[model samples]
Target chain A: MSAKTWLPLLALAALTGCRQDMHDPPRYRAQGSSDFFSDGRVNRPVVEGTVARGQLRADTKFYQGREGGEFVKTLPVELTKDLVKRGQERYNIYCSPCHGMVGDGEGMVVQRGFRHPPSFHLERMRELPVGHYYDVITNGFGAMSSYASRIPVKDRWAIVAYVRALQLSQNATMQDVPEAERGKLSQEGRQ
Target chain B: MSQIFHPSANTIAKVSIFGAIFFAGGLLVILNEVNRSPYVTRVGVAREQPVPFSHKHHVGGIGIDCRYCHTAVETSSAAGIPPTETCMSCHSQIWADSPMLEPVRASFRTDRSIEWTRVHDLPGFVYFDHSIHLKKGVGCVTCHGRVDQMPLMYQQNTLNMEWCLDCHRAPEKYVRPREEVFRMDYRPQESQQVIGARLVKEYKIRKLTDCSVCHR
Candidate 1:
């Protein structure tokens, strides 16, 4: 009836026509299992109910560590090492811009304009366990978004484990290292 | 007091009391029926759907994943109801002849979403994140019951506090491999409790017994 309304309806009709055109061609797919599964192909999207093939999690005895042993432990997840490495790389990509290269909260973004996050080593977090660290990374403790979608579960754990490594390295003392290693370092530096 | 034979008066009094008791019993039964799941009853009264889209048929018989039809469990904030296109994916081949499926075809042409009544629901504030639960290895059956076996999927489990606490207190009882976690009727395929127990200890789980663990 109105000129404003007619223009919008005309535009909407064009948009629907465009969508109908797009659907006319099978441009996208659900990425179901293809040759990539058995042929050592990469990036297979595991849909629901598609018996997880070669899932690293399969046969992983429920334990804290990676093995099925007498003693119980936290998940030494199948991706424990791989995830940690990926996390470090991803952290460098997505987080290092703000949380610093080492998660000390002195990232380039913070230096430039963004608010600094607490160093993962700070008292508030030094006492925090891996779950707390993971929660923060996933949900963003403060001024952060949920990386729940961005980071997969296994990778988040890896980042948490890596953060622990960073903390350990920063707080290391001479006694903490092997005496033989310290001797080599001292000698190498002196000579 | 019995100067005259009061047998007729006595009979009338007995009939009056008996009639009153019968009326009360009938009223009680009617009230009980009205009290049971007031929501579904109102739905039965109004909004006549063109086809009886039984969740029981899809979930119970064919063992279709809710996400298969809902389709938004992972990426979106809302797990969207199935569009006619999603239904036509199967119905176009399977139920092409059924008059019941006529509504589905009509819906596709009309571009309308099927208004399937949500049977099991929670308060909006409760904020149940299906994705988070999925990530934690909480199986669909933990809340939904054995949906794949239903002919007409009905709400089997009451989403009450105690029901949730029973699972949360013993997450190992419910937690399964992430792959099978979406299964609507998956019991632990193996003994994960021993490993689950160790994880509980190793992780230094502080709040198994705490209310906030599940309530929050």
Candidate 2:
């Protein structure tokens, strides 16, 4: 062959040799079948009672939202300003899409046409224990899906605190606010 | 031998062969350049969808939050596309009879999803989690551009590996306060480097260049 023809051929040969096909071996992809296992699945069962790193949920009250087979009335986490702020942020991101910013059940999503969630201001909702909110978020209710996969456990309690705050904001009398803070409501002529 | 070979004809043949080779090489180079251009890549091109949803009207004019429609952005790997019910919620009251929203109404009635053409598509090999990015305070505008300004959504960034690596190598530069993640118009009051350094420490963001970080 001519040198010109051979030169292109040589370049092609060099390029072909650099293929990554060998690096990507024929292997079982995630959740793929494997005849080597008796169950014909590549995924191994989580060994008997082994807990995953950083996933030990020994505290039934915090992790499960329940104690003694009943939902707890109060939050397990300390209700700090930062924690409530975090809850507000998380609520706006996750719950506000459906539950509205003030928990009025008139969120943009509901206004747009999805099923309206019950208002937090309702006597029944206000009377419900705080753990009920966490339980609902963890397991989902009616049309809503479980938020457990998205929100961390600590954040879930934080959200519960915010929900309680929302319930109070909606149902509060003038006495609920401090004397100094009451002036802000009167300034808006809402008092 | 003299009769069998004509010098002038041989010269013409050699010149033509060389010309053909050069032409072919030039054509290949031009083709490669064209493929990489914005026109071919559809970088700013507004892709046609089943319905002509205007981000300018929804986001800019009305000031709807990004989370209103993309509900699963904070928790799911994929940013959840709004179901048809979300559209009908408003359209059923406002543009009840507009032909433009017929697809939405039909999808709502049939319980079928509207097949929205994906704009920011990554390659199959790359694994991107929207939840992780949102949790890490990477604002929607960082990768999606100023969507509020777009009349019709388009692929703002190239979304290539190089583009991803630019931020992955130094996440602090793009990190913002979690509260500001959804604020489309938010601008850093301080210099990005200064704010980013603080956010990097606060958020505990590590500069990740590992191939498996994305490739897996």
Best by TM-score: 2
Query: What is the per-residue lDDT of model 2 for residues B61-107, given as tens digits with 9 covering 90 to 100?
Result: 65677875776777778786776656654565567678998988888
Model 1, runs deviating above 4 Å: A1-191, B1-50, B198-216
lDDT of 1 by residue, A1-191 (tens): 99998999999988877453432333222221234355222334367777655655454332122243332234345545676676675566456655777779886546644556789778777777565666666666556645554556666667766777677777878898898799887888798
lDDT per residue for candidate 1 within B6-30, as digits (tens), equals 6698898889999999999999998
Cα lDDT computed for each candidate against the true fold: 0.60, 0.81
The DockQ of each candidate is 0.02, 0.10
Clash list (residue pairs), candidate 2: A112-B89
lDDT of 2 by residue, A1-191 (tens): 89999999999999999775644446754344567987565657788889998879989899988999899998888889988888888788678866888898887757666678899999999999988889998987777766775677898999899988888777889998899988887988863
| Runs of candidate 2 exceeding 4 Å displacement | A1-87, A90-167, A170-175, A178-191, B1-32
On DockQ, the leading prediction is 2
* Ten-residue stretch with the least lDDT total in model 2 chain B: B85-94
Question: After aligning candidate 1 to the native by TM-score, how far in Å is the CA of B165 from where it should be?
Answer: 3.0
Fraction of real interface contacts that model 1 preserves = 0.00
